[model samples]
Target: MRPFAYERAATAEDALRRHAAGDGAVAYLGGGTNLVDLMRLGVAMPARLVDVARLPYDRIEHRADGGLVIGAAVRNSDLAADLGVRADHPLLSQALLSGASGQIRNQATVGGNLLQRTRCPYFQDISKACNKRDPGSGCPAIEGDHENLAILDHSPECVATHPSDMAVALAALDARVRVRQPDGEDVVPLERLYRSPGDDPSRDTTLAPGDLITGVEVPAPLRMPARYRKVRERASFAFALVSVAAALDVSGGSVRDCRIALGGVAPRPWRAHRAEDALRGRPATPGSFRAAAEAELAAADPLPGNAYKVPLAVNLVAAVLTDLAGEAS
Candidate 1:
């Protein structure tokens, strides 16, 4: 609970200006669901809070091509309940609903959801050595309680998993983030938006100092069967041990096209390109599904505590794709 100045911005320009005026010590407020929690834990201490929740980015626009432009300020509950979202991109809607509780979802915005930090105990404690919290200090999670940490695309410096269920679906859908940056506006692919911990575990995203996510542009609907399945320690409110967001298209008992993205297994939403490549043109069978999933997970390098995530992810992927294949059949 550090003392900080707060200002509400009426426009994106205003928000950016306010952030700049803070001299790089500002955080954009969007619902305050995740950011506030971190602040209370003393993990984040911003000198100023630019309230971007009031910005004019609160609408979900339906494109003629069956795509959608979802505003950053749109609440998770609203996005999940949108009729167009339910009918067209059911996976996205399903992922949103599967996340936090109804009350939290009511206040959590799309942008905030994407920006939520990991729930890693070491990272949150502040007393522990967390590379993400203090670069080069060390990542105790690597040898500490890492049962829920990453198994894919992880480095020795960091094994923390991205906690956004919505992001996994967006990666599968090939969504792009529209950002208002210091230079100008740019549309960045969802996959490119995040970078692996690599050598710099402190930086979660590729966004520069003054980049603001304006909205997410999901490309045209798949018009095919899709599913989002999550496995957690509990029934609800718990983060996924492993989650799969998958869409499959089948014709003549063969896979036509498919997209897959994995969460809770990597530093970012891991697009299962290897799996997709293996499944395309293959028979739409459980065996094929398993093989594709295995191909994608072959590169997994898991720690002792989190090694179970590898098999969990493999089975979850096969099961989800199987369910979607059944629906298509």
Candidate 2:
């Protein structure tokens, strides 16, 4: 790792100020789970580190509207174990538990997890040409080792996929990301926080350079059965090949409302809006689930090696919705 100046900020304002003053490649240190690993791999070369781990953004507050506001600094494990979260947003809890091992979950913060970088191998190898790591550079993953890459909404410039299980749940729950900008604070929908690679793969999120993520606000609880299912190469400590986070509200043998978001298949959390539209007011049957999943996946443009993901996603979505529907009954 390169030598860098390190400072701990007691407040968000101080952290932003320090970040703004830094000459080059300034990064906020949260759990040091992702950023430190990137530094070690020479993929990230920040000139200065501002430790935001000590900031007072570690609480989980219940809102009067029956929602919850999760502080950015709250550890992943703590968030998953929170009684309110497990009871109200079981999907989020399940997604967190399905992610990295206990050690990593203990160190990874909610904000950090949302902002974590892609696990693309090419992006991590400094010697290789990765458009996400270096703008204008060619993306080798387009033709090499792309089986685990994106299958939807990927640009020619980048095929990498976001690797956050928690973000997938947030997307399904229609959460808002709270950020502290230099001029003022802003609340952005979690879905809007991420951007497709498009022509500039160097940028991972829509957040401005100095914007600090403060917390996330989930709207009123679904009050419906939900599930987060992941399929990976191993039982644990592995990234998802395809994952689904789904919530369903069924009434009288029909679907009243539903939300589905996919991971390991897109640059951002792939909110299955098309599927939701198809499933709403429809019979909660295996056939209906399959059609909805297909409707959402019809837009997928998978590479030759990853075409299997389409069927995998289809089956997973159907199974999760069917299981949830059965439980609802």
Candidate 3:
């Protein structure tokens, strides 16, 4: 086993200091949901751990701007049960409920969920050839059991999808992520936080290694009707096969505005740009939904085993829009 140093921070600033002094080789400790497992598997060999567990950023607050303010360390379980958040943003509550079990939810943090590694088996096994784990190593999933992997926004180097159900909901709401870099703290729009894996799959996020997510700010809801739909192999304990989050407001039987995002079939929580573009200022009908889903999926690049996801996701998008349109509430 590789040896490492551990330092606990008294404040948020101290955590940043420990991370920067190590030249970005430091890992910020969250609820240890994914990180602890990676360390045991030898997938991550950080030289130091900056434990930010003691920081006072674990509370979930509602902003006066009519938005949700989730601290970086807020537990998944707590976030899911917050009355205000659930009543206003059902998409978020639904995502959290669909994630891991109750025990795991109590231990996972929103900040860590945003930064969790891919669920690709090859990437977790060091002996296997995985581009995401070792930059130059060829991707084994290119010819392996990629049925459970990504089908959209994939490049030659990688097809691993981001694995957070909550993230998909957040993306649809156009949330903002706060990061405490080695130098200072700043906020980044959620849509730009993840990068597509082109030739380099080893780099997973835009967060420089030492940078830690400090909090997430969900903007005020557009007052448009919104909902989330998730389908999985199991009802209670599984990741989505094809999930969708949407916010729509129809004016005079036409779509005046909409926000769409997809999960479980993309490199990131895919903001359906094609669908979003196709949806705005159009008639709210099943035909238009089909056209929109097809337009967005046109750019998807699927692997040999996961091609079925394309049609599955397309159908799901159409169904979700139809259900949401029929709802009177």
lDDT of 3 by residue, 186-265 (tens): 89989789988988888878877667788999988668777888878887787777789888877788888888899998
- Model 2 misplaced stretches (Cα beyond 4 Å): none
lDDT for each of the candidates?
A: 0.93, 0.95, 0.86
Task: Name model 1 segments beyond 4 Å from true.
Answer: none
Which candidate has the highest lDDT of all? 2
> Alpha carbon lDDT of residue 4, candidate 2?
95
Which 10 residues in a row give candidate 3 its minimum summed lDDT? 320-329
Better-scoring candidate (TM-score), 1 or 3: 1
TM-score of 1: 0.99
**TM-score for all predictions?**
0.99, 0.99, 0.96
After superposition on all CA atoms, what RMSD does each candidate show versus the true structure? 0.8, 0.7, 1.5
Cα lDDT of candidate 2 equals: 0.95
